[model samples]
Target: MIKTIIFDFGDVFLNLDKPATARELKKHEISNFSEAMLQKNREYEKGLMTSEEFVEEYCSSFPQLNSEVFTGSWNAILLDFPKHRLEFLKRLKREGKYTLILLSNTNDIHIDWVKENVEFFDEFKNCFDGFHLSQEINLRKPDAEIYEYVLAQHGVTPEETLFIDDTSENTKAAAELGIQVWNIDPAKEDVTDLFTIKKDLF
Candidate 1:
């Protein structure tokens, strides 16, 4: 009885190399960010800080890098976005199978990069019933509150929602709220596997 589909953008749709940016920054000696630094980065994505502020903080941590290098280092995380996924999602939107929503933990710098790179970004926004970015919502995934917020905002029953994500922890969070979920691994299974898993529903 799932009446809605929730998706995570990075690993679920676009392919992101989590290590790439950090690795790239390592060359610039800004590579040694601790878990706390990562947590702060997530805070920025959760709309707790602006891109300029986030980059400045990062730069302050490593004064050797200029603002340009910091921004480049930040953007390296978003390696590539494929066209096939865009087409697939567009098809789903056209089919009107369910209430489609994009719930991603993303920030302004990366988002601005996407807008500049992807020709379909504007169209992709139209595909979703609600396109909620953690940076915009001030809430990030793996947090129970964000999931609850989306559920309440959409009037969606937990049992009536299916969430697709690349992170097991993220899917687990949604599952905890009684939503069905799929954890897709790009290195192992493709996002298209979601279609096979949910074939009956479609």
Candidate 2:
């Protein structure tokens, strides 16, 4: 039986145009997302590098682009958070049937946009018993250690938790630790359908 629920925030909740950032950056003739740049992104996500350092690296790479434009393009992937999903999460919190948690791989730049755009960002967050942000925790998904950290922190057994994420890699990592998972496709499904879609697990 699942006593706890761990959720991923990006596609699972807030809609994201995953390719928007790359597309926008390419327009500025910054076509190469080199291996080093990818590594830097991973470091930024893991909170190993501060936002100032992260932005500086990109600025140095593309001296032609202004910081404001670079920041805007970097945050282009974020989209709207459907109000219905917020209601569904609120209902779940009220029921108190499970310990709800949010585990997201996010960075400061993206989070800043979310806070400003999502009207209920604060309320939506209050619904979770535990909230873990990659930048804040210095950990990220698709890594076994992060999952282990959440499990240990909550004192929840893998078998007793259900982890929902839109990324297959992330779900795969969680499953390795014996946790139940729902690797959702945001294009075809919505988080609000959790009860009906994953009824077997519930």
Where in model 2 is the C-alpha error above 4 Å? none
What are the C-alpha RMSDs, in order, of all predicted structures? 1.5, 0.7
lDDT of 2 by residue, 55-149 (tens): 99999988988789899999999998989989999999999999999999999989999999999999999999999999899999999999999
* lDDT tens digits by residue: candidate 1, 91-110: 88888878999999899999
List per-prediction Cα lDDT, in the order shown: 0.86, 0.93
lDDT measured at residue 126 in model 1 versus the true structure, 0 to 100: 88
Prediction 2 global C-alpha lDDT = 0.93
The reply for model 1, stretches above 4 Å from the true place, is 200-202
CA lDDT, candidate 1, residue 31: 53
Model 2 deviation from native, Cα RMSD in Å: 0.7
